[model samples]
Target chain A: MTWNSWFSHGAPTAGFTGGPSIVSRNNAVCNIYVRGGDNALWQKAFFNGAWHPWGRHNDGAVLASEPALGSMGPNHEHIFVRGTDGAVWSKAWNGAGGWSGWFSHAAPVAGLTGGPAIVSRNNTVCNIYVRGGDNALWQRAFFNGSWHPWGRHNDGAVLASEPALGSMGANHEHVFVRGTDGAVWSKAWNGAGGWSGWFSHGAPAGGMIGGPTIVSRNSGVCNIYVRGTDNALWQKAYFDGSWHAWGRHDDGAVLASEPALGSMGPSHEHVFVRGTDSAVWSKAWSLVPTVILHLKVLTNPTSFTVDQMVASMRDVYASRGINVAVGSRETLDLPLLTDVDVSTCIMGTTTAEQNQLFANRNGVGANHVVAYFVRSTNPPGNGCAAHPAGRPGCVVSSTSSSWTLGHEIGHVLGLPHVSPSDRLMMGNGTWNITNPPPDLIDTERATMDTSPLTVNI
Target chain B: MPVTMRDVRAVLDPDEVDYSAGARLGPEAFDYLLALVRDTDPGLAAKAAYLAGVIRGERSEEVVAAAAASEDALVRVAAASAAALLAPASASRVLNDLVVDQDSGVQKLALRSVPADPSPELRSRVREVSAGAAEPGLRAMADNVLRGLH
Candidate 1:
């Protein structure tokens, strides 16, 4: 949840005129492509645990604006930019074929006024957003083994800057632009195969000064980072089925150009902005990974039942951006499993019967967590997060407090008990925590972020 | 050394009292909590009530029952749940009071606290709630519980 300080990553100064498009290929290698002062596309790669020296990959191709970068299935990367002739050109690279020579897709007759934004839905499909010569938004795609023709999708809004794109789902994209009205306007595919009208997300009071950069953390969640008129970094987050107000991230790093956002899956999202010093400065948010839990209910207590426990866990985990409630739930009529004997699961140990119950996950992912709801643990114990090694889960007492479920599961995700009752990992009985929403500190968040059970939101 | 009401309130003030960890306070703490539940601060009263529920004694059920009457919705809701853990002597009436509480959340946990085989009076109250409750969500919950009983 908190961002790291602004680190320049040894950003090149001269000829860095303005650029910094960042992408992670296969979530392993990060290639930061920027339009160099020499009007050519250059890159600095981070792989094998080190940053490589800056190198040009465009074969001295003259670019009219900054370059956009995207990846397809971890094997291929595509870079799109405006050529000297006002046409949009691309240079593709594949793991097998290395880098290919630049080729022109031929721009709209009106021509491209800014760089393109690229999103790859799958290995074969990619969509590009651009600011057209008419000052409206336009797009094209590469699917069915060929490039589609230039098409405009402004919904009657004129743009003052280039557009940023978010992937809502396969075959659906959301586009946001800094409209000439000094507001952020969005037009998205309705998911039912239709386009939505332009909707304004309201800008900062002084209005925005540059284009917006976006990174979709998942299907329903995306965040827009931009430089406001005050020269500060401002962001608008869309998640939980709605858009929140624009909040400023005042880290004291003044933005000099439009910001660009990229992420390595769920690890973190880095916002790269050309700072006042004309160097690419970046800050990143350590994103939380989802904890998928499968519950085995024993006797549903009068209070704090398994269903209520899961709902409470969802709200607790939301503080760190984990939608643990978004997973599937079904009723299986297995009588014996439905009514289990947790009698032997005492203290910090699980019984053989408990292990047998867990053994039949019924195709649940190994990385997913399973919670066994029982009537009670050993005397004086409401739950225990210990199971046989290699099987990660916990046993919960049906009478445990609302925070106990999350507390035990937090143990599964590498959290240790702390003294304060106002925390989720409180060693004391969760039943007595005064805090309604217990805290999960950053270090605990980092520990959970690295758990294999986590898939980034 | 005897546990004073101040000692009980001080321990309960900053964080919650988890006697379950180790009986730092005892059945003696229950009477002190009962006095503190009358504190003007409803938040402190709510905390006193929950700690009383945790340290159930002769007065624990009544402590939550009194908390169920606190003007604070949070206090009432917390009592609605804590009532399930204390004395079953007055459990039905306390739960029935909570099930029809003005707060839907209180009604929810109270409905949830209904035993697998409920007393006829509790079952009858559930039937009334299922037919007509202010919150549709609460009504649906009662309806579902009624169906499962069948």
Candidate 2:
């Protein structure tokens, strides 16, 4: 079917290439930045029904990748794009203000290509991840009001597609990309450590032809989806540690567009992609019970004591028909660790402790469970030095608190950094602790549902 | 052993397999093969419908007919498109019923399968649906089909 309504921006192009990043904040607002006729970073934002003009970057020589957007705070959002100079730069708009002038960040190891992906864990804290010239994943985070060194970069063989990120825990995140071998690979970081070494899930049954998209329902669990060589949609998921087989769909059309996902409910997530005919098609499934419970923890690190944070997360989840529970740790009986899936835990921090607690409560059969600790470095009123870990402890400052949680949780799930300086989850831009873009939920959920889950042979 | 439907599903990547191998099974073999669409498993049914799209012959018509009338929207959409590829005439008739199908998804597939070149009657019918269809997706598709005819 003709999808005129869905063609919200950009006329058809000859190449399969278009803007790789499309994000919707609260579903009411969306920004899609593309490589324009001039090869500059061109953007269009959706407000009301119409798409705004093709806003070009005036200062940068040329954008090397797609622009990533995330809220800097309650009323402000930031856009990060890579320049031809191989340095990452940013611009912000805090509702009261329009797009601010561009600001540059310390360039990661040179030659960055592809648009960055940004996700705000909280208002002040964010991380940007990108693939360097070496085709290795590199990251820079906004911690204590400054950008950190691009974390130890590692290669994933060939990097033809951009990366996608998702929150894994309060201080953990995951990055996913298509390896040179055409298989999906992942790496993650916990608050107490740097990125873990790269790990290959397995080759997708079908040849992957496009970059993957990721979203996390909770820490340590995520689903990934990509277009196959035949132009059909293919998926692989990380649940309880092992990668599942690739699942294919017969949706009656070849999939040519990047898939977007949103939450249908707390236990349900859906993915949407443009068919070859340009029609938007979607598929959804209910997550298993253990997966649902685990996702809640990652999405809401403060689900126990932080009423405001929980409320905000709940509002976003509820808008998508997701059921969420917010209360204190004392009031709720957290599920035993063993009963949960633990295959995708990142090394370091309280992950071992949390996993141990879970296992003690459950049993060996609960090895599939994945658990993450929501510690903060900066407690209220503590200066940077007093902040836990000599940085802001997990609970230290509310600044990067939520955003960091979102970023870390992304790792526990299955996403990877999309841009080196984009956002924490995708490693493209700065982190803002506002509600995540609504489509982020959809993208993650859809990827998870469609991703291959290992079946007992 | 006969090529069971399970064998087809077990194929790591069907996109890499040669559709001509199935074609060698002949029309009757294909028809018997298409009957597998009625399998209870949604994944299996989905796979069968996908494979049916590659079969060529009159018996393929019967397979498409059965799939078109399926209760499953996924199967119906798949069947509608598969039918359009091989039997445009019969496909059009099936697509008409689907054009008004309850699910916006089915209607979408039906609109897509409708022949690009339509008889005047079909053109008029598409126009009517284009103007009256409630769902935005279906209305747009109907309008598009009618627009292409001119």
Q: What is the Å distance of residue B79 in model 2 from its true position? A: 45
lDDT of each: 0.72, 0.51
Residue A143 accuracy (lDDT) in model 1: 88
Position B91, candidate 2: lDDT? 65
Q: For model 1, state the Cα shift of residue B33 in Å.
A: 28
Model 1: per-residue Cα lDDT over B56-124, one tens digit each: 667778787887787865566557666766655456667877888776656776776666566678889
In order, what DockQ does each candidate have? 0.04, 0.01
Provide the lowest-lDDT 10-residue window in model 1 chain B.
B14-23
Global local distance difference test of model 2: 0.51
Q: Give the lowest summed-lDDT range of ten residues in model 1 chain A.
A: A335-344
Alpha-carbon runs more than 4 Å astray in model 1: A287-457, B1-150
Q: Which digits, one per residue and each the tens of the lDDT, describe model 1 over residues A1-457?
A: 4476788855554457585888887667888888888787778888887778788654879888788888887888888888888888898889889989999888876777877777886678888878888987788888898888989864667888888887756777788888877888887784576888888898876777877778885677788888888889888998889999999886787888888888876546788887777777787778446788887665454365667788888888878766584344444433233223233333356665457756756666778887776543322235667666667777665446777788888888888778887888876557667787888888888888788877654
Which ten residues in a row are the worst by lDDT in model 2 chain A? A378-387
